[model samples]
Target: MAVPRQSEAQEYIEKQRIMELFDNITAQLVFHRPDNPKTFMIDYVEKLKESRTTQLDFPCLFDESNIESVFGMLDPTKKGFITSEQYKESTQTLGCDNVDPSPAGSDMDMITQDTFRREVKTGLKKASATFEQV
Candidate 1:
């Protein structure tokens, strides 16, 4: 979409935040260096960036300031990242958290590191997937 202009301050800010999150995630995933995996989570941001052909996407939120929206949608309390307990709560709320892969499945939701990237895609928009449906 040509990138929303400053008039859409809200939109611009949100995109920036999402990008920041993507960068943070990209760095983290790069650190872990998981084995050849089909899905993301460990490589969410980088994969998405490659998938989208742009460095402006995150798996956490579609918008930056709206990251809390994800917390609300997934976590709700705004306490921050998902821990074991918080993950359970997120599963109940997100329902689809199970769609992610978790070899351990001990995290209460059968979610593995791969799930984070899939769901975060919920909020991101790559030039390629922009026309995609939810």
Candidate 2:
């Protein structure tokens, strides 16, 4: 038996990332819980449209102070660097899941705060670009 191909509607939804958009909107609604859901959705979609037209600064979505705080939490001893696994976990926690967790250069097991920040920002920008393309 052969697998059936997706219907045109399903293909369109996948191609245009409609489900992802809807999921994001739904998540926002649940998180914010505005009194006027209709108005909130309208504004949310409008902002999304505007963002697509403008140059959004993806890195700004995560504040520098907050990133530093996360890094500090992961490196409680005030160590200048964290293990690669910790770096990967922290970046994923920060919503940069696409980032490569390996440390740069010959140091295969450690990531400094500066390196983490740079990689996270780069990953965010790349993710934003991919989303916009969709």
Candidate 3:
């Protein structure tokens, strides 16, 4: 088989890692909006800026850049909003060509990734510590 280009390998690694992160974010993301859309957005933003996992190895919860990227995850157009219809459409093509912009809105259907994210962490305390350091 032909060797994959260096950039290709790097891209693969990064994609795999971020996809895993997205899976984890989905867990909290689901509970995020149950009561209030306004607070949910603020809460979600805070969670990203401030990691709260018990493990320390995962990405920092609130890395502004990652949070911003997460904000743009589904918004290729960069409009900064997602709707229920747009949310549902994303699940059909995750891990395939279907999920191009990465569904900036929602992905509860792909909870398998959430499981992976939890497994990667050791404890909420440890995870929280990691977020504070940054």
Task: Please give each candidate's TM-score.
Answer: 0.25, 0.69, 0.26
- By lDDT rank, best first, the candidates go 2, 1, 3
**What is the overall TM-score of model 1 with all chains considered together?**
0.25
Predicted model with the maximum lDDT: 2
| Residue 75, model 3: Cα distance from true site in angstroms | 46
Candidate number with the higher TM-score (1 or 3): 3
Candidate 3 C-alpha lDDT tens digits along 1-134: 99999999988766545444455456545644356655755665466555444333333334435334433566667554544344444332222222323332235433232332232232332333322332
- Cα lDDT over the full model 1: 0.45
- Point out where model 2 deviates above 4 Å: 1-5, 57-62, 101-106, 124-134
Q: Report the candidate with higher lDDT, 1 versus 2.
A: 2
RMSD of 2: 4.8
In model 1, the worst 10-residue window by lDDT is: 125-134
Task: Decide which is better by lDDT, 2 or 3.
Answer: 2
Per-residue lDDT of 12 in model 2: 71
Cα lDDT of model 2 by residue, 19-63, tens digit: 757766776688789999999878777766666667464312455
lDDT of each: 0.45, 0.69, 0.42
